[model samples]
Target: MSPYSPVAEPPPRVAARLRRPRRPRRGSALVRRAASPVALLVLWQLASATGVLSPDKLAPPAQILRAMVEEWHKGTLQAATGVSLQRVVIGFALGAVVAVVLAVVAGLSRIGDDTVDPPMQMLRTVPHLGLLPLLVLWLGIDEAPKIALIALGVTFPLYVNTVAGIRGVDRKLVETAGVLGLSWWGRLRHVVAPGALPSFLVGLRLSLGVAWLSLIVAEQINATSGIGYLVTDAASFGRTDVVVGGLIVYSLLGLATDAAVRLIERKALAWRLA
Candidate 1:
C-alpha cells in the first residue's frame, strides 16, 4: 500500500446511527417517579372533602397526618418506634448469624447438608405465626419469645437462599480456581462467595421483611409496649386515627429498612451492578 493513501469516511447517517441519547438526570427521574404518589394524595384529599368515604370509620388523610404530628410532638411515637426497631435489630442479627453459619456448614459438607437441609426445608413450609403459640409456651411471654419468633421467621429464607447460592456457584470457576493453585478457603472466599452474593442479598431483603412481620405479630401478643401494641391499643379504644398513624409509622420503618439494605447491597456488589 502507498504510504500517502487517503481513506473515505462513513456517511453522516451511519455515524449518527452509532450514537445513543444521554439518560435523563437523577433528579428528573425522581420527580417523574414521585408524581403518582402526589396525585394519589390530592385524590385522597378530594375524596375526604367530598364525603366519598365515611370519616368516622376511616379518618381523613389530613387527620392521620395531624395525629402523626401530635404523636411525634408527644415523643410517644419516637419511643415506640425505637423499641420496635431495637427488637427487630437484635432478632435480625441473631437470625442472620445463625443462618449464615448453618448455610456455610451445609454448603460445604455432604453430611452437614443431609443432616440440616431436610429439617430446614420442612420447617420453611410452616407459617411463622403458627409457631407463635409453641414459642410462647417454650420461651414465655417475655422478650425472649418475641425475639425467638422473629428469628425463626427470618432464618429459613436466608438459610435456604444462601445454601442455594453456594451450590449454584459455577463448577468451571471452581475448577479454574483449583488449577490456579487456590486453597479451599481461597476458592470459597474469592470465587464461591462473590458469585453467591446476589442471591444472598435477595435472601437478606426477604428475611428483613419477614423480621418486620414477625415483630408485628409478636408485639400484638399481650405486648405492653411497642408500635404494634400502640396500634392494637388504639384500635381497642376506638382511636382509629392513632391506629392509622401507627400503621403509617410501621410502613415508613419498613421502607427505611429496605432502603438501607438496598444501599448496602449496591455498595457491596458494585461489581455486579456494573
Candidate 2:
C-alpha cells in the first residue's frame, strides 16, 4: 500500500451556533408576583368603602398608606424604625457571636461539649418570653431588657443549627485532612466551615425572624419610641390606620431581612447549583 493511502482526513470543524437573545420577562414576572398583594389591597379598600369592614376595627389599605406617609413626614416613622433596627442589629450580633463560639468549642472538643451543651440545652427549654417580668426586674424597662429579649430569642435557633452543621461534617474529610498533616485550624478553614455554611445560613434566617418577633414583644413594654410604641399610642387614640401601618412596617422588615439572607445563601452556596 502506498504511504499516502493510509491517512484519513479528520472531519472539518464546525462553528458554534449563536444563542437566541433572551426575552425580558421581568415586568410580567413582577406583575404576577405582586398580583395577590395588590388584589388584597383592592379588596381592603372595597370592603372599607362599602362598610363591609369597619375602618376603626381594620384600617383600609388607603388609610394605612396615608398614615404611613404622615408618620414618615413627622419623623416618627424614621425615629421608631431607627430604634427598632438598632436593637435588632445589636442583639443579633451578640447572639450570633456567642452561638458560634459555643458551637465551635463544643464541636471541637468532648470536654467543651460536655461542659457547654447541657446548660445551653437546659436554658433552651425555658420560654424566653415568660422571662419578661424577670427581665424587667433584672434589667429594668430600659433598652437593656428589650435588647436582651431579642438576644435570647436569637440564640437558640442559631445554636441548634450551628451545632448540627458542625457535627454533620463528614468524618472522611476530617480524617483526610489529618492524614495530609493539616492543622486543626487549616482543616476547619478548608473543610468544616464550607460544609457547615448552608446550615449556618438557614439558622441566620430563622434567627432574624425570631429576632423581629422578640423585638415586637419587647418594644411593647414601656417602649418610648418604636413601631410597637407607635402601635400602642395609636391604639389608645383608636387610630387603626396607624396601628396597621406599624404592623405592615414590621412585616416588610421581616420579609426584607429574610430575602437578604436568602440572597447571601444563594451567593455563598452556589456550588450546590451544580
Candidate 3:
C-alpha cells in the first residue's frame, strides 16, 4: 500500500441515500390536523347558504355560533360550564384515586384479587343510567347523587385497565429484577409501573370521557344548573340552536380534558416513547 494514499470515502450520492426524510414540525402537523374541521365549517356554510338543509330543524352552524355567543353574553354558558367542570373534576379525581389503590392491591395479592374482583366485575356490568333512579332516591337529587354517579361511571375503566396493566408486566423483567436481588417493592417501582404506564394513560383518557357522559346524565335530573341542564331545558323548549351550542360546549370540554391527560402522559412516560 502507498503510505501517502488516503482511504476512499463513500460517494456523496450513497451518503445522501442513507439519510432519512426530515419530519414536518409539530406546528405543521397540528395545522394539518385542523384542516378537516375548517373544511367541514366551509361545507356547513355552503349547505346552509344554498338551503340544502332545513335550518329550522337542524339549525345552521352559523346560527348555532350566534346562539353560543349570545349565551356567553348572558353568563348562562359560563355558569353551566363551571358547574359541569367542577363536578367532573371532583368526581373523577376521587374515583380515579380510589380505583388505582384498589387495582394495584388486587393485582398484587391473590387474596385482594379474590375479595374485590368478582364484585367489581359485576358492578361494571350494571348500566350506569339504570342506577340513576336508585342513586337519586338514596342520595337525593343534588350534587351528591350527581357526583356519586360520575364517580361510579369513571371507576370501572380505570380499575380494569390498571389491573390489566399490572398483570401485563413482563415476566422476564420481573425475573431479571429478582436475580438482581431487588425486593418486591423495588421490582414494582422499577419494572412494573413503567411497563403499565401506556395502558394506564389509555384508561385515564377513557375514564375522563365516561366521567363527562355520566355527569351529563346525572345533571339532567332536577338540575337547575349545569351544561346538561341547559341542554335538557333547550331541548324541552325545542330550542335546537341552544341545544346544539350546549352540546358543542360539552364536546369542547371533553376534548380539553383528554388533551390535558395526553400532555401529562407524554411528560410522565417520555422514556416509553424512546
Candidate 4:
C-alpha cells in the first residue's frame, strides 16, 4: 500500500483510544449524586425559614433532626428501631424460606406446578391488607398477625422471580450437565442454583422493599411498639417533627437495606462481570 493510500487506517490502539468514552472522575460522580438531595434540603430549610412551609402541616428538616436527637436521648429511638428491625428480620426469613421452597417445588416438576401454582396465583391476586381483618380475628391483636402480614407481603415477589429464574435456565446447560454424568443433585447444585441466583437476588431486593412497606402497614394495626407506634403517638400529640423524623428513619432503613442487597448482588454475580 502507498503511504498516501486512503486504505491505510489508524493503528488498533489509536482506534481503541478514539472509541472509548470518557468516564467522570470518581469524586465528581459522588458529588453529582449528592448534589440533588443537598439542594432539596437547602430549599426546604429556606422555605421553612421564610414561613412558606407551615410547621403544623409539615415539620422543617431542622426541627425533625432536633426531634430525632431528643428521641435518641429519651431512648425511644433505639428501642423502636430494634423492635422494628426484629420484626422485619423474622418476617423476611419466614417469607424467603416459604417462597424458595414453593418456587423449587413448582419449577422442578409438572405435577408440583399443577398442584401448587394455581392456588398461589389466586392468593396473589387478593390484596394482602384485605386479609388483615381475618388475620386479626384468627391470630389476635399481637405479634403473630404483624409478622404474618409482613411475611405475606414478602412472599409473592420472591416466589414469582425464583420460579421464573428456574424455568428460564438454558436447556443446553441442563443437557450438558446430564452428558457430563452429573447426578440430579449435582446438576441442581452446579447449574440450576447458580443460573437461578440472579433472579432470586432480584426477588430478594424487591421482597425486602415490600417487607418494609408491610411492616409500616402492619404496625399501624394496633401496634404497641416499633417505629409505627412512635409515629402514631407523635401524630396523636400533633408532634409533626417527631412524625417526620420517624418517616425519615423508615426511608433511611429502606435505602440502607436496598444498598446492602445491591452489594450482595455485585459479589454474587461477579462471574458475570468476568
The candidate scoring highest on TM-score is 4
Kindly state the number of residue pairs that clash in model 1.
0
lDDT of 1 by residue, 1-274 (tens): 1111122223233455677855667668778889999999888778878999666667778888898889899988899998999999999999999999999989888999999899988988988878899998998998998999889877988898899989999989999999999999999999999988877877887788888888988999979889988898888877778998898787777777777776887688777545
Give lDDT for model 2. Answer: 0.84
lDDT, candidate 3, residue 40?
A: 93
- Go through the candidates in order and give the clash count of each: 0, 0, 0, 0
Stretches of candidate 2 off by over 4 Å are 1-33
Question: How would the candidate models be sorted by TM-score, starting from the highest?
Answer: 4, 2, 1, 3
Q: What RMSD does each model have against the real structure?
A: 12.2, 14.3, 12.5, 10.8
lDDT of 2 by residue, 1-274 (tens): 1111212211111111244554776568778889998999898899999999997799888888999999999999999998899999998898888889998888778999999899999998888888888999999999999899889988887887888889999989999999999998999998999988877876887788888888999988999988899999999999999998998888888888877886787688778754
Looking at model 4, residue 182 earns an lDDT score of: 99
**Which pairs clash in model 2?**
none
Which candidate tops lDDT?
Answer: 4
Candidate 1 has its poorest 10 consecutive residues by lDDT at: 1-10
TM-scores, one per candidate: 0.84, 0.87, 0.80, 0.88
lDDT of each: 0.83, 0.84, 0.83, 0.87
Model 4 CA lDDT for position 256:
84
- Which sections of candidate 1 miss by over 4 Å? 1-36, 50-52
Candidate 3 ranges beyond 4 A from true positions: 1-56, 179-181
- Model 3 TM-score? 0.80
lDDT of 3 by residue, 33-107 (tens): 899999998898788789996766677788899999999999999999999999999999889998899899898
